[model samples]
Target: MSETRSDSTPESGRTVNRRQVLARSGAVGLGIAFSGALSELFAGTASALGRSGYGPLVPDPNGLLDLPAGFRYQVLSREGDRLRSGEGTVPSNHDGMSAFAGKGGSVHLVRNHENRVTARFAVPTVEGITYDPQGKGGCTALTLDHRGTVVSERVAIAGTAVNCAGGPTPWGTWLTCEETEDRAGTNGYTKDHGFIFEVDPVDPHRTGAVPLTAMGRFQHEAIAIDPQQGIVYETEDAFEKPFGLFYRFLPNRPRGGVGSLRAGGRLQAMRVPGVPDLSSVQETGASFDGIEWVDVPDPLATRTPVRLQDFGPRGITHAQKLEGCYWGGTCVYFVSSFAHSTEGSAADHFGQIWRYDPAAHRLTLVIVFGPDTEVQLPGESPDNICLAPGGGLMVCEDGNGAQHVFGVSRRGEVYAMARNRQNIGTPEAPEWGEFAGVTFAPDGRTMYVNCYTPGTTFAVTGPFHG
Candidate 1:
């Protein structure tokens, strides 16, 4: 995956590539590694696709996975194929996605499968393995083109449960996130359990399951909506036993400026206000950084679920596996695939990129990955994040599957554009999985990545820097 080395910077040392032994280590934007075909010719001119930029990487383009030179990615759909809504395909793990842009230009993907009714999937018209033991996980609604193909598809939310990672709602639609309430023991979960549900990705109503329970339930992950600033960001895929919190919904219907938090919102959790609300949090290796902002007073419920530290502890640190969240520029970024230890108690190994400078309410960390030698990586975390309009930052790496969907460079340098590890090509030729929800196309120039274990969806366009 490493190639083209002109060397203007990035010599922290260590280099190997294909054999996998690279790591100049550093991350955030604009440098280059994994050989990146000579810095992908200075990272421009692949096409004007989605304009992008960012900086921080002294040189940490996380070595190997290729796709920096003149960027390009296509593959609009996959997962047993057969879309247009014949209602047969789609059924896998694929998590958190939300692309919107349909007036005619076409594109509305809401997708999120995370199926767990017993796995199986592959239902192209019910030939085999459509197995609906109870069906459970859901979310779907494609409508691609821009090269990612697939013209129509639906199913916005099925059996329900476990659906993981979601965000995108200023009134457009999409809030998926169902991460779980207690399904670990095997219980259907028809009661509010782990919530947040709203979809309309240009057509999705298979009975239209709507459960914004005011946006609260617990165990949910990924979801960040501000719609100009209406506020919604929530995340927490509880690894196990812990009240697990991180929320902020506040929309009781007030986009008077850019609102629409579902019209009836107010959900809130994660009480950094004096800290100490505990039940769980701090273990995935634990490390903890700094970023504090707490006030949900009780968006729906959670003045106490588990741990706010018993009810007295605030000063930052607490994101671990927080999974993706985005709002680039002014800042709102959020990711913690791992990190927690500041009395939170044990867990660490890398991943920590925080932000929330809501003008300067504070809360910052910016970049903080771990491996080093050039950027050496065995992989264990760093999930969902997006901001590549020409700004840098598109990581997915939920560890394993071969993991690949990194692009950190607001100066932290980390390449590996797309690599879902599938050595094949069908459904018209596609191969960009495991890259988890990374959108763009408001003008970002096409780029719709997905592939959460089986629910694939791609549509990347050249770097086209010019």
Candidate 2:
């Protein structure tokens, strides 16, 4: 973790303290108004209390996941578990994922493996869907019945690298992103990496190894789609000093079904007139109006990286660790996992959640996580995020110490929903891994999440609020 920095912004009058932002949650529409299960979370006053959610979480007797008393989790898949297809075992480093409706009332989960060339278990390279034979990262599909029992699992796409966080499309497809900018011959990769690939939940054949180049070639993290205009919003998770830029793609064929993004689109990076670094602004409810989008001169990054490209005098805005992204209500929600002044960020903080309203051409800071002395707490570096079926938000912690899945209620209260007790390390050194891919089934009955290390996926069900 980085040292904490001053929570001051250059702009005046627009900045508000975190406490004030929570107190005026209703006035600023703090809660997300997304459709379906993603409706109202963070609408009321925000509370930093730990027990405000479903009460204290009870320890699990199985030495796996600890949840609240009434809630229970079933292990759907593990890293080395053999796939039903017999092609290979489940890959390592399970990251971004999304759940879709499957055949006969089942649920189909498309998961990503953040594997590199040195990974032990690589996503099996199926003939037609394999992109680059040397690339060691890709996605897999898991099927769970209504009873939350594993039905079948297989490889969705293969021959990619560093498959990190991605988002789902309104047209029932999953967009898997590669968080890398490695070239073909650099890392033994036969093809250029760092592009988004669309995967169809039902049919693996539909998702060939074609990368959506029009979506830009950079260290892609996650993406969210606007259903109305079919605009695709993307986040770049570049670890370099310049950090990454937020992008939006205007697809030629707006909302077409599968394989539409491959038709090519105009990619653009976001720019806030005077704001060059997002971390510099620490005030909650800090809204930036008149947000501008600059067209990328080279989306392919054939010469210069997208973030380094010239974007006029008022260059594009950059954020460190730009991770999880989702489309809710009429706006797009994104997360800057964390920032460190030591790492060249303008400031330091735990995390931030920003809402971009396309209709209003405005961007507002809905939530700002203050520095936490205890890294094991709920409000640390929040990575992947999703809406709870009942209401509120579910966040994955990627900070130090104990890792947990936190729930933020409609009133903005944060609580521990689940904890990972799987000790992948030795008993003398007990190390717990971070959580990722927090999503809910369409029926709102089952919640699915992933454990990054030792790579495990679990389906949790209980008396949810919805």
Candidate 3:
């Protein structure tokens, strides 16, 4: 399930697991476009000692979320709550989510539920459109007013598998991705799973579930889109047996508007020359230039994994637990959740952030998470990241121990923003759930997030540092 990489370069022209090390081998030379741009953007550490945020969080007596002095949160939705039309109880294990504009000063929150066949709650069957009748995972839509009050709530799409983390398209649609490759007729699943489905945020019930099969079927974690070029960047959250690849899909017909993904697209995996099978857990601030994309032979790989598809002479690089990707400020910010010394050609680290500049064709290390034993709380496994309105990035943690919604500054400074204080369950057995679905409202006043365990969505408002 895991592989290690040596510091010394492999013999010239030698191939290992489709990775070929060439004669010219060294750290890619840094260029001004990438080096200077990042240096200027991240001039200094903004969150050193948690100074950029509202400050230390006060313990919540209600056993909910703990935030800073001026910050306050409102519980918008919770598990087992009544649905809009009484379809069923609200699903649990909420994951990634997005907030869109609604009529009459309201915001539509499109959220995902990461439940399985054994889940206590199941999204209602819609007959023909349901991917798997036995699958219990799906997404929900909640409408909240400007003050974070719920206006309406309903199940958007249902019967999918592991509706994990996904991104919102520029054209007003939520792309919910399935993180499992579980085949149909196996384990009670009646249909093939592991595909991205587009949900119309306006009216999910009427639009019907449309899975974008051309995007490739893999252990999809998250997706990011470049609005300018109409290209979609994807991350595969595969671990153990088969590794994941960083991919980009070029749509044959560019986005005319929402739901244009049905037209199909060509998939390609990324490869950085010289550093074949690049293990991204390298030295902090290291940069690799001129990264190339290799075409994937079969986009819909049922028997063989798309990442394992060989491209003859030039092979693609494999990354461990690739998750949480976003497109912002002309670059793609992605996360490698966790990795050990045994995987790829990098040192052991809990988490890492990579910045890919499409125009420059370069990938640079942005943040290097320290060991878990380290004292820094925010330096944990950062997942489900999004661009902050007030500069820098907002990261959700899924690491070991206490989970939190931390902030990563432009200069890679980490700081604690919010913590989970939900102590529900038996006295002997308690829950220490991780935070997910971190996003901001279109108006930029309210920040919405999800607690993955019992499924509680919160709308936090305060004097943000935008």
lDDT of 3: 0.74
TM-score of 2: 0.90
lDDT of 3 by residue, 1-466 (tens): 1121112122233122221111110112100011112332344424432234556677888889988789989998888888875777888898999999988888999999998887777766655446667889988889877666787888788889899998999888889999988888877988888899988877885557777999999989999999989899999988663478888988987763666888897788887666554454355456776677777777788667777766546566777778899887688878887776575535456677788888777777656554324533334577888866645567788865566787654433455678888865566765578899999998777889999987899999987775
Task: Provide the overall lDDT of each model, using Cα atoms, as 2-decimal numbers.
Answer: 0.55, 0.81, 0.74
Per-residue CA lDDT of model 1 for 1-466, tens digit only, reads: 1121111122122112232223332333322322122122123423433334322212224422335445555666667766667776666767778787876576677777766556667222221212222545777677766545676776666766667778776667777777765433356543445666676776555225656666666677887766577777777766643435566666766562222444676554443322332213222221122223444333334334322323223322244467788765455666766554543534444666555544434443445454443233424367887766655556777653345666654333465566555633465754434567777766677767776655667676774232
What is the C-alpha RMSD, rounded to one decimal, of candidate 1? 20.3
How many clashing residue pairs appear in each of the predictions shown? 88, 2, 1
**What value of lDDT does candidate 2 attain over all alpha carbons?**
0.81
Q: Candidate 2 — worst ten consecutive residues by lDDT sum?
A: 29-38
The parts of candidate 2 lying over 4 Å away from their true place are: 1-52, 374-378
Weakest lDDT window of 10 consecutive positions for candidate 1? 1-10
For model 3, the superposed segments whose C-alpha errors exceed 4 Å read: 1-51, 127-129, 276-280, 342-346, 371-378, 424-431
Arranged by lDDT with the best first, the candidates are 2, 3, 1
* Whole-model lDDT, model 1: 0.55
What is candidate 2's lDDT per residue for 207-288, written digit by digit as tens? 7889998899999999999999999999999997899999899899996788899899788888766889999977666778
Window of ten residues with lowest summed lDDT in model 3: 25-34
